[model samples]
Target: MWKIAVGFALFAGLALYILSKGGDIDMSGEKHGADATHSEAPATAVSAPAAAPAAPAASEAK
Candidate 1:
């Protein structure tokens, strides 16, 4: 049991060390795609249709 625990600890430590040294790690959880940094507003403005006014609902009179 002790041997297994030690082995697992060592393996985890080694993996963490290697990952820390690697520059490709992205911990920010942000998208790294080419268009990820661009604003969505401009694209939506260009392609979006104009909003139409809502129609008034008919009232039911007794």
Candidate 2:
């Protein structure tokens, strides 16, 4: 129905307006080669450090 079309248009407009207000909005579609690089570099995955030897528990008084 025409109502559906009008609702879709309004929703799309609101979405576009919100995206425009954002600090970063890339509407240039897909990219390739060097242009595909993201602003932030992928974080290097760090291996967790090995745990130290556990201390021996003290004996309880008899």
Candidate 3:
């Protein structure tokens, strides 16, 4: 029982240590020194297509 408690304490301590040093780790999944803001244009702006001209009326076609 004491061994199990000691093992758990050690594991918890290691986890806390890793978390404390998390700033040194790049967990952002982005390339190092890359600008996150300029990675890509806005989705709405990119996906939208240019507006087409209005169709001519039947009388106007004649």
**What's each prediction's TM-score?**
0.42, 0.52, 0.38
Candidate 2 C-alpha RMSD relative to the actual structure: 3.6
Pairs in steric clash, model 2:
none
Please state every model's RMSD to the true fold in angstroms. 10.0, 3.6, 10.8
- Local accuracy by lDDT, each model: 0.78, 0.90, 0.78
Q: What does the lDDT come to for candidate 1?
A: 0.78
Alpha carbon deviation, residue 56, candidate 1 (Å): 93
lDDT (10s digit) by residue, model 3, range 1-62: 99999999999999989988886554567653545545356676456788999999999997
Candidate 1 lDDT over 1-62, as tens digits, reads 99999999999999999998997765666786683675435644456788999776667433
The prediction achieving the highest lDDT against the true structure is: 2
**Model 2 residue 58 CA deviation in Å:** 11
Model 2 residue 40 lDDT score: 88
Number of the top-ranking candidate, with TM-score as the measure:
2
Residues 1-62 of candidate 2 have per-residue lDDT tens digits of 99999999999999988998897778899999999988987899999999999767666433
